[model samples]
Target: MSVSGVREAAAIWARAKARRDRDPEPATVEATAPGIRRRLDLPGAKLLLAERGGRPVGFALVAPRARTLELFYLAVDPDAWGSGVGSRLLQDVEQHAREVGREVLELWVINDNERAIGVYERAGWVGTDEVERDPASGRLERRFLRHIG
Candidate 1:
């Protein structure tokens, strides 16, 4: 989506985010739209969306983090969770990252989000004990990354 559409895009974000806490500010879709889009469009950033049957089902957002590509955000429609959209997005991004000679695909996940962490691990992502809080939740989280060919 374009920057102008950030407001509309915010609605989907509200639906996509799995609640980590009872925070209301981040959940205010309209307010977070602009900043979220700005962050995604920063230098060396990439955003990919997954659509099928004319509807957006997933999105993957990336940004440069030192020598790595940080997966800043990734979300699949709860209804499409097991339909391979997430995996496809990852593979597509991985290929592009490799073509650009990126050393790794890094991302941070909430410690409580075992599902995503497991998915990444299965995709060859390794875990690091170094943890931090997602500003939105203040929950303990860990970083994961995988090297590409």
Candidate 2:
């Protein structure tokens, strides 16, 4: 992804997060650039962007772990929710994971995000009862995993 692409991704991320919380801080290019650069430089990192009508509508960033693909970030433009953008992005992630020899797909979702939780569950992801704090936002997060081969 290009720097501009990361900026777009950051905007989507911020919009999605803010929809779940009041007055959430926005993610700027400066805030997301370093991580984008770092991930692009990583050997096992996969970044996928979903576009419609030639405009980006969603993105997913996954990194390879020992036996799993960690979905570090996934976001769809708020206006595109419920339009299958999230599902297509996730399916792309799973395909990438399989191509890379990962056996499982894992991600953390903020506990109070019922919409996201429902989407994940409907996609066959199972909650693991593992809770953790998201350092950046101090939100409680639940772990979800799916065996993807």
Candidate 3:
């Protein structure tokens, strides 16, 4: 990711977090850039950039966490929302998770985010009955996971 991409991600995250008015983990993506980069550089972590016919479009960053692969960020350009970019990115993530021996793939969906919740559930993700308060926002997020062989 370039410095500009990091800036863009931060801008996007700001809008998202502010829209939710969530509790508070570091709201700025740049604050987490170092750590994000660390994980992206890790052996089992994968960063996938979504492109349409060779044009960059979006990004998804995944990391192996113990027995599961964590979907860190799945960002799609606003202009590309209706396309299959997000779906394709997710499928690739699932495939990578399975190849790495992860029986489960996990992601945090912000509570009250009906759209994302619907998409994940329709994609076969189930809630884990766990609520985590983001250190940055203090709002609680429900954990969701999908099991894949």
Candidate 4:
């Protein structure tokens, strides 16, 4: 996915997140678009989309840092849950990190998203248990890390 694909990919992320978030007010496309565009413009930032029968079903956004690759966003369509889309997206992100020589992969998940946390944990992501409030939604989020390369 490229900068031209931001709007579609952002919609996939927003919709999937909305279905899974415990918070009453989920992120809206209007609010997430600008940040998605900014990230798309960043050097070393890559977006990967998963499609089923040519229809977009998931997306992952990885932002490369000095020593780590941040899995900035990963989401699958709610309808595609339990179909391995999330797992494949995460795996692809790790492969990308390895290709870039990143030592680790990092991502933040809302503290209340147990399903997502479980997915990451099963994939060997270890959480430091540190929590921070998201400025946009005031939701508590936890950071997870895993050595990748």
TM-score for each candidate, following the candidate numbering: 0.83, 0.89, 0.76, 0.89
Pairs in steric clash, model 4: none
Candidate 3 or 2, higher TM-score: 2
List CA RMSD, all candidates. Answer: 2.8, 1.9, 3.9, 2.2
Candidate 2 residue lDDT tens string, 1-149: 67778777777777776666664565665766576667666668877888899888888888998878998888887788899998888888888888988879999999998988888888889999899998977999999998975
lDDT of model 2 at residue 76?
A: 82
Model 3 per-residue lDDT tens digits across residues 1-149 = 57665555544444444444554543566664665576667667777777677655766788899888999877665556657776787888888887888989999977877766776787788988899988866878899999997
**Which residue pairs clash within candidate 1?**
none
> What's model 1's lDDT at 82?
77
Q: What is the C-alpha lDDT of each candidate?
A: 0.73, 0.82, 0.73, 0.84
Residue 8 Cα positional deviation in candidate 1, in Å, after optimal superposition: 6.1
Query: lDDT of candidate 1?
Result: 0.73
- How many steric clashes between backbone atoms does each model show? 0, 0, 10, 0
The TM-score measured for candidate 1 stands at: 0.83
Show the lowest summed lDDT stretch of 10 residues, model 1: 18-27
Residue 130 of model 2: what lDDT? 98
* Model 1 lDDT per residue over 19-125, tens place: 33434534566665766687776887767777889787777777777798888777776677778887888887797687667878888888888777767887788
User: Which residues of candidate 2, in runs, are more than 4 Å off?
Assistant: 35-41
